[model samples]
Target: MTTRTDLLVVGAGPYAYAAAAYARDRGIDTHVVGIPMAFWRDQMPADMYLRSGPDWHLDANGEHTFEAFFEDRGLDPGEHDPISIGVFLDHTEWFAQRKGLAPDPRLVVDLTRPNGTFVATMADGDAIEADRVVAAPGVGYFAQRPDWHDQLPAARCTHTSDLVSFDDLAGARVAVIGGRQSAYEWAALLCDHGAERVDVVHRHDVPEFAKVSWTFVDEYVDQTLAHRGWWRHLPAEERAAIGRRFWEVGRLTLEHWLVPRLTPGVVHRHPGCAVTEAGSEGASIGLALTDGTGLEVDHVVLACGYRPDLARVPYLAGVLDRVAVTDGFPDLTEGFETTLDGLYVIGFAATRDFGPFYGFTKGCPSAARIVVDEMLR
Candidate 1:
């Protein structure tokens, strides 16, 4: 069977909720799909805290904020410096409810433009024809499992994105790979979950977490909106370097919060080292490191994070061949619209073009405003 809407929002996270709410309020018939906050609720550690501050929220018209959510729930949000994961999930659900957003709890298996309009085929064979589509599958689509990872036993090494819960891993020693937020965050969580030991292995000799101002984040979004031609003219490497610099501050600064749980005895971090080789060690995972030392662990977790490669988006497989790309990311216009008319990418997929803001909750309102303005145009 087939249905129709003016807009199809493919993911139900912060980006999709904000986009659909704004579009719908503007009188656009918007249909949202995918489970709400699926990534945070399912994949992230149960007790993980948000790396961002209280201002980060999924408000469509900027009327609702995490502060507002907390106020309504009879709590002073200011009391909690960094919100807990569970509290963030509650806030997201409350925001969705307030926006009247009930995303179709099914996956869009395939999307194609066989005719003039776009058709989204659902997992259950239902179809939705739309004049426009907003794709925001979040970071899960862009997870980076390195090629060298295959050297380790599949059961031994797992991507951080795939980790649902550490309940069963109690008392098991684990090694978390990477130097950034995910690696450090997971190492702390594993420790909290009663893991016997958690070792962080990274290639950098000294992990740096230079301070970056929040004003810089706002500047990125504002500058992109003000002068996109100049923004796009910048080389991809230069843009990535700036974004990486901004991103480093968040991850590294956030790591300080985990230090209480990650101490000298509870957690050990090995810097300037890379896993050169790996195999099964009797009944455990064995790793040969670049430091010329061997280590054994019950399991290994790769917190390498995601790359903005469009190839990682599964539902877009049917349509990817036609869109123009800039350095493996979707090439977007000033309005966040893809090469295809009436179609847009708002989340991580739009980061490279829209700047660093689009990848975080704080950028949702700006991103939604840009896309809605374009769709109205």
Candidate 2:
């Protein structure tokens, strides 16, 4: 079946919801397609808490702030200093329903450019056309597969993003690579779930990330605020390069908080080491490091990070090719528009154009304001 609308907002994450809400407020007939809260619901572990503090609740509309959601539900946000994933999900579900922007939970299978509109095909054989298309489908699910992992059999190696259950790692000695929040959370979760030992390997002497402070979020430190016009004049490649720098510069590693809570000897840290080879030995996996070290583990979890692969976002692939892309990520303009006329990207994908904070909960409101203004005008 084919339906049509003024704007088709793909993805149902914080970014997607924000865009849809803004558009709806302006009386734009916007249709949001994709699984609602898929990342927070599926990828993130239930036990994990948000890295940001309570004040950083998801608030696209000021009235629908995280605190407000909890308050409406007879809960108190102040009671939870660090909100759990479950609470965040509850807030998102409530917000989505309240705003009447809850998406029909389904994967967008393909997107193709028609004569003057975009033809979006869904997994269930539904189709829609829109005057403008917003590609906000969160991050693609594929984790960055490390080079060392190619030698290992598929079953023995898996990215942390792929795991839905810890039952497979029972009594296993697992090694997780990277020093970001995901890596630390995966290590903690594995140890909590009965893994024999979980080794967190990092290339740095210690896991470190930029300090998180509300002051840094202000205009002076976050260059995006100072140079909002920079993206429009620069070439796409240059813009993306600048965006990546901002993203890396703003993130705070989980080691800052998780290190103190680690159980003695359950989670080991291997600093200044890198995985160089991975192979399977019967039920175990053999991993070799660049530092002339080797370990035999039952499983390997790669938390290395994510790559913005256009292949997973089939709808934007052709449109993406027309625009400039750096390292497989879309190159967007200051307004988040691609080279394609009616196509725009938001959230992490728009970081290059919007700056480093584009993917965070805080950035959603500003991005929504920008996109809604552009679409309406």
Candidate 3:
């Protein structure tokens, strides 16, 4: 089957939905393809909590906010607090439906430019052609697979993004690497599910917590939300260094509530240690570390999180060869267009150009505004 449109919004995450809605509103013929919120629905644990506050969500043309969804459903909006994964997923689906968007749900296998337009082939052999292509990938495309993990068998090492359930891991000794939210959250979840023992191994001494005030968000929406806010006019290195600082405070932070649940001894911390070698050791895995410590655990969970490297995305592999990239991210214009004409990337795909904000829902509105606005011009 073949379908054609002026714009192809590829991905079902917040970024895709926002782009689709904005493009359609601007009178651009847009077709969205991909399962809506597939990452939040499939990759994330069912009981996990989003680090974003209630105010953050996949909004449609500035109309359908998560707060509005809560209000319409007669539920308390919980203004400044974090929301559960379930609620966020529901809101995403509602945003899709409300915008009259029903994604094709088929995975894009490859994308190519034969002439001026682009062709996106799906796994089911369906074809789509569009003058412009927007790749709004979710976090899984960037799941961190530590290089050292290659020494261990796949059965023993898994990233936190890949786990659907902790049921099979019950009573198994587990070690979760990284000091961020995923590390602490997964450690707590594992212990709660009765893992024999869970170790949180981190290169850092402690976890960072959310510290940005809501006022910061207000300023962001009204004025400071672009490429690096005040740092936008700065040199690339300056912008990126600022991004690194921002990341340490935001993405690397742990949810305060997780600390209490991660009781001592049950969720052990091995901070400032590095795992140098790991391999199958009978029923368990033997992990040799920089601190001269060795661990024998049934499983090693990598909560190291994701890096938005286009090369890591199988579907985008064909297109990546031509796109300009700096520091593992696409070199995008203000409109999110890649070096290749008419080809665009949003969400985390635009990180190197747009900064870290593009990866989160909070940036969706601005992303939507930029893409559609540029498309019309």
Candidate 4:
């Protein structure tokens, strides 16, 4: 049987939930599909902490914000400064219930538009037809693999996304690549899991652990909603300046809370370095660094982060040609619609056109409002 909906949301993360809630509230008959918060539950470490605070949430109307969740549950916001993944997931469930949004929990195996209507094939062979489709894919599909990924035996290599639990690595020596927050956080988690030794190698200087403010992103998100093509219309230098500001706060600064978890001698930091060469060496992987250093580890974790590529999305393979892409990101309109009519892409993939804030939960409410309003128009 074919399920029909006016608006089909192809994910159940923060972006999908918000968009669906908003669309339904506007009488769009929205139907959502995907495991709710699957990426956060499976890809992230079991005991991981989020860099974002309780203020970030997925309520498009802003009536049931995370702050509201805290108040309703009588949980003090200060007690959860750096929120845990578990708590955030609970809040998402509460928000969904309050909005009467229950995702189908089925994966969209394939997506294509035929005869002026969108058809989505579910993993269980069900088909859903809709007038419009809003896909809010998470970042797991876009994980960036380094050049040396294939050099070593596959058993000794893993991406951070797939290495959520470190129990198996308790007695192993591991090497983590990338200088970003994930790299450092994973290192700390590995230490907590009893990894004998962890070597963190990166091409950039080690980032400082300090508290930083994200209030600066509010203005940009507001501008994105108030003015069409706001981010793309900015002057070249202005865009560059904004990018720099984000890099400084989001990348150059890590949460001071991670400092204690990264034990001194157990987790070594090799900054200003790159893996020039890597190969299997009997029981371990041998790595040659750009700084003329060498290391041997039982396993390697690639925390190089994600770069959105529409073609890499498995479900979009059938209709990918219909979508225009810049670099790897979709060429979206100011309202987050892709080149394909009535189709929208949100979350991390929308960052290129909407600005970096769209890649975080902070942009959820605004993005939901913008996309739904555009759909109505």
- Candidate 2 or 4, higher TM-score? 4
* Model 2: pairs clashing at backbone N, Cα or C within 3 Å: none
Across residues 32-101, which tens digit of lDDT does each residue of candidate 4 receive? 9999889988888879888988877888887999999999999987888789888898899999999999
Candidate 3 Cα errors over 4 Å, as ranges: 79-81, 208-221, 224-232, 236-241
Model 1 lowest lDDT segment of ten: 205-214
Q: Could you tell me how far off, in angstroms, the CA of residue 19 lies in candidate 2 after the best superposition? A: 0.3
Which is the winner by TM-score between candidate 3 and candidate 4?
4
Error of 1 at 56 (Å): 1.5
Model 2: lDDT of residue 61: 55
Question: Tens digits of per-residue lDDT for model 1 on 1-377?
Answer: 99999899999888888888888889998999999889888888787777676677776566878878887999876667567888888888998888888889989999998887999999999999998899987898788886778877787789998885887789998988887877877887887789998888888754654333565676666666567444577888878787677756765544456667775686877888988877785778888888887878999899897888887788999889778888778888888888877779888888766666677888887788788988888
The alpha-carbon deviation from the true structure for residue 231 of candidate 2, after best TM-score superposition, in angstroms, is: 5.9
lDDT for model 3 comes to 0.79
Clashes of each: 0, 0, 1, 0
Model 2, 111-183: lDDT tens digits are: 8886878888888898888999888866644368777788887777878777757877878899988877788
lDDT of 2 at 221: 20
Top-lDDT candidate index? 4
Candidates, ranked, lDDT: 4, 1, 3, 2
The top-ranked prediction according to TM-score is: 4
Q: List model 3 lDDT by residue over 1-377, tens digit each.
A: 99999999889888898889878778889888888688888888998887777677665366888778888778775552557888887887887788778888888999999888899999999899999998887878788877889888787789998876999999999988888878888888897788989887888787755444433444444453444234255578867775776666675666676866786777778889978887886787988878998888999999887787788778888788789887778887777788999988888777665656666788888878877777778
* TM, every model: 0.93, 0.89, 0.92, 0.98
Clashes of 3: 1
Which residue runs does candidate 1 get wrong by more than 4 Å?
A: 206-213, 228-230, 233-241
Every model: Cα RMSD to truth? 2.2, 3.3, 2.4, 1.0
